[model samples]
Target: MKYNEIKNYLNGKFVSGMGEKYDVYAPINGEIIGEFKAATKAQLDEVVAKAKAAQESWAGLTAKSRSKVIYKYRELLMKYREELSVVNCEENGKSMEEAYAGVDKAIELTEFACSIPQLISGKTQDVSKGVNCKEERRPLGVVASITPFNFPVMVPHWTVPNAIALGNAIILKPSELTPISAMKMAELWEEAGLPEGIFNVVNGGKEIVEGICDNKDIVAVSFVGSTPVAEIVHKRGSANSKRVLALGGAKNHIVVMPDANKDAGSRDIISSAFGMSGQRCMAVSVMIGVGSIDEVYGEVVAKAKNMVPGVDLPPVISEAAIKKIEDYLDYAQENGAEIVVDGRKVKTDEGYFIGPSIIDWGNSKKMSSEEIFGPVLEIRSANTIAEAAAIQNESPYGNAAAIFTQNGRFVDEAIREFQAGMLGVNIGVPVPREPFSFGGIKDSKFGYGDITGVSSIDFWTNLIKITTKWNPEHKVDWMS
Candidate 1:
């Protein structure tokens, strides 16, 4: 499957778009690896119409039958894991290991969706005498997923499989920067014998997105992007009377108690801050050291300084990303923060790379609160555990927070008081497995549904209740 052959997958076939084609670049070497045609208005309309028509028969299928098709899709995904990883590495600027991990995560969600039969089961209870009520989940007519560029394949799978398996049609609008992976997944869906129009891929910028939002046929829209864009999507989609799940940005914080092991805590902190070049929403951006600021700071800076930029650490997504990170670096120094490990010294000619950086904000809460989205860690000191917890709770973004301590009481207190939607006791990135929901609170999320697990199923479907009563003797009284 060469990149040049990539086209919009519509109605179970590859269809050429009517608009101009744009070049797709490999982030690693800054070379044009392929090109994709932006879908036109007519093409988009046809795609939606086909999706609506195909969804009727798809929704008519039993859950058991749909699960079989999903199982086959998972099998194809596993068989093509290596090839998919290569594509992910080239376009996403992640290391080979991280690319493989992304594919593996996609596979995990696909496997989870295969259990839709059991997950979508209805419940029956007696509401009153001689009346029984049943609650069942049914798919929305048509749904659209707008994913970000960071985890291209995995994020789409976070929505696609669940929506389709539950009997809804899907229109996937992947990030223009990394649309190749979505095209590849569409090919795999065709190979798995999925019905035509059950899944469609549209590649474009804001026009396609606004079209999906305004289209009356699309019942729901799911989005993952920056907070500003997520808010706009949520507002526009909800204004159109559609269900929307818009997951936004985050500036996650990690707390290190005095009783925590310095070495272990540093390891977790380094991994969370630098992994994926700190582009992930759950990445730890702030470190709140309680009564152990000096010890934890020394340990974390020492380990981070030794990591090589492009070789040991992953590169940032694009040159623009690198410049954005550098701007943050310059701003921190200008604001009187002490630079511990500067990432500017680490440079590479082949790719957009930046080494891990640590900035000591020293009781000032200026740049420590923003989402840097790069491998720059800010250290903030707290006088006591209560103050540290307060600092974590006061942040407008309640995405993820972690507390490291050996004391059982402190761990318990942190778990209870932390305002984040996802909390970690010792783990740095405590994203739960496939069956659990993945999202944040406050400005970190806009809607009720998260991306993966049962939350995904719930988002793609609407609950329907049925109340039934049967009386054999009185059936023909009115007619007679």
Candidate 2:
């Protein structure tokens, strides 16, 4: 299907700015689907100014009123869910099933953000010395978000709607690779009668991004990408004193103990290892298990083999991603890691596809330290549960780690020892609900605030405490 030419969705309209428009190819078969404008610094400045203008009024509205607009947008999203899902799948190269879920999850995020009127309400505290003290959360005026390509819809949903619902005008910089879906979301907001400039979608690379981050009008910047790029953005944005939340790359792990249920662990491993083609920041790229569980490890390999590769999963984000996966596979093999399963030959005419592969990288140095964002996993065998836990702790990335076990003591011990920002006992990916915020630790995530749900409103806005007193008997008017 041919998609429309998407330019900058700026200030209530779509306009082609001064930049090269690149053709978006269908990853499966390398077909040119449509053209998208690469934004320039000028376009970004204009958008941010508009956002700042819009945010003034948006923030003036009550939290309930602002949330109503987001709620209406959520309804419109459901009404056109199928159309959006198709667009997501065709452009993103994910299987139809995964695309459907991504759309659904985005809708859920919008709805969740819409239900936070009470959560954003200011609080009051009783203080002595004849003073009434109160503190209230206020909108940060204008904010910016830079989302990754893996889950274009879901990642931004994790940022934008919450910011808008909490009364902050938002500027979103979606990945040029799959920017159409975000533009579609902008249209839905307009249809929901949202004020112009309250939400703007700018499509571009670094020039536009830096312009937005450095702009004084934009108060905060949220980003998700590789560790190196995230660090750069975080460093630069924070240098200007902008509130920045930059989510970096992760080498998440799933540890298995000898006492763990082998069947269940294998299932969780398969799902977490290959879900979304392992393009998610939360996907388990490494598996640390006790060496005594060799039979269970074999079971994991056999499960990976049964996965139909290209037919069952979406392709990696780009051709470069495919090359990275291939290079890592070869590199791991060359470094003495045993390839228990190889999905390199998987074929799909429509997208860049790779199936599922498992590598026993126990003997290979640095194999367990890398984050391969594809349908590949490295299994590291440890002599004991302590060794497995140590392997999980030694990784530089502490975004998330999962342990599978039935023992309460083991679960509690692992919980206390794992250095990850997020942990899952039996679950694979423990991305939290709207009430709980999502973030990572170490090099995985930057900044001091959470990006979504209630914390989003908290992060997008600052707090001010107010104190007042009225006493007629002791009225000493000091410019009262």
Candidate 3:
């Protein structure tokens, strides 16, 4: 693949302007593949102005018309799925299989967008004599979608498809680390018959984020990233009177009961902890074993030990991520934890490679509680299933949690007891698909609505209700 320098996609074209710039690297092999310039505040305002200008005409189209365009875009995405998957893998450093899955998931979100006409059909009711009320979904004008680098295609689709399907013009400020795939998608949107200025991509760092938050023309914001940044975006955007939904970091946990399916449960648990190199927000960080659950733990460790880097596990996103993950391993070891598998020493000569590291998490609550967005697994022991749940509940984040058990009572209890917005029973990664919605409770989510599925319709638009009384003369005082 030929690597090229990327620029801002503004007003239906790839354009560049003066601002802070950052270099983009391919983490798989440790090479500087490209550089992207941040959009200046003026450039940011220009794109927002363009979106504002386009939103009304776009919204004027019937819902079915909007859905048609979205469906076309989905088709275009599917046609180039392999190419996009390659770009995702090249830029984000996930395995080819994982990268393909990410792009496929993005396309799935677009498929969900194709059904927005039905979702926004609205409602009407006859309130009283000669009186009627109708409630309808109205587009929120210009909305900004801010995405993370982890899932190049998937994260943007979390809000973009839903927002655009609701008839809103979008300004996508993707992570500078992975701007190539986003810019490429802009081309596909144009090909799919989306109007000029209706969809735009502006790559930047902090200034562009502030631009998105503070710009009055932007009516809503969708953000996905670390907890600290998610909080900032939510507060700043809300302070500026824009609707905001921000998904943040998480330390997702899974509990293993004594009666759980030991062999199969352990394998799935290992996958949950190590898949995507454990970089996913939904990845299980801590596994709590209830009494006599050693079978599951032992099996999980056994399966994890055999993982081979660059083949079984992909590299982390950056050199800094390598150091960050290793620092955690060092800290854990120094704090009475055992490093069951030392990923700190990489066998691969090239790439930002790090194998899976398993920690016993003996006395380090810090290691178990913190969000280690890497292929690091921490294990702990608890006396009861409730005790294990209590340990998971201690986390400040509530993105997702899972339990492996045969008892219906335990599953039912976990459904009520787990604080996570997404839950799993005998499942590892329990991310909800379309129509089910995805978001978390507590610090995991900053705003009121989920970023995807049926629940997201409210976040991307506003409800407009019309009350009519053409002939309101109720002279009939006779009780019927």
RMSD of each: 2.8, 2.3, 1.8
* Ranking of candidates on lDDT, top first: 1, 3, 2
Count of residue pairs whose backbone atoms collide, per candidate: 0, 5, 0
User: Considering TM-score, which of the candidate structures 1 and 3 is the better prediction for this target?
Assistant: 3
**How many residue-pair clashes does candidate 3 contain?**
0
Error of 1 at 447 (Å): 1.2
Best by TM-score: 3
**Model 1 / residue 402 / CA error / Å:** 0.4
TM-scores, in order shown? 0.96, 0.95, 0.97
Per-residue alpha-carbon lDDT of model 1 for 1-480, expressed as tens digits? 247845788888788777867777777777778888888877888899989999999999999999898999999999999999998988888899999999999999999999889987989986555567899988899899999999987899889999989999999999888988998899899999999999999988888889898999999999999998999999999999999999999988899988788888889999999999899999999998887556767888989989997777877888888898889999999999998999999877877787888998878877646688989898888887788888888788988999998899888878887888899988999898878989899999998968788878778888999888664445344421
Candidate 1 Cα outliers beyond 4 Å, as residue runs: 472-480
Runs of candidate 2 exceeding 4 Å displacement: 347-350, 472-480
Ranking 2 against 3 by lDDT, winner: 3
Tens-digit lDDT track of model 3 for 1-480: 365668788878889757887888888898888887788999989888987888889999998988888999999999999999999998999888998899889988998999989878889987766677999998989999999989988998888888888999999998888898898889899899998888899888898899999999998999999999999999999999999999999999898889999877988898899898988899999988777787888888788778889889988888888888888988887888888888876546788888888888753465646688999988888777677778888999999999999999989887778889999988899999888899999889999978899999988878999988765566543321
lDDT (Cα, tens digit) per residue for candidate 2, span 1-480: 387687677888877767877777767666788888687887788878878888889889998888878888989989998888888887788777888899888988888888878776677864644557898878888888999888877889998888888788888898888888888888898899989898888888888778877898888899998888889999999898899989899999887878778788787878888888899988998888765776668788887777775566777777888888888889888888888888786645556887788888774456746778889888887776677778888888878998888889888878888889889998788788767778889989888766776667768778888988754446344423
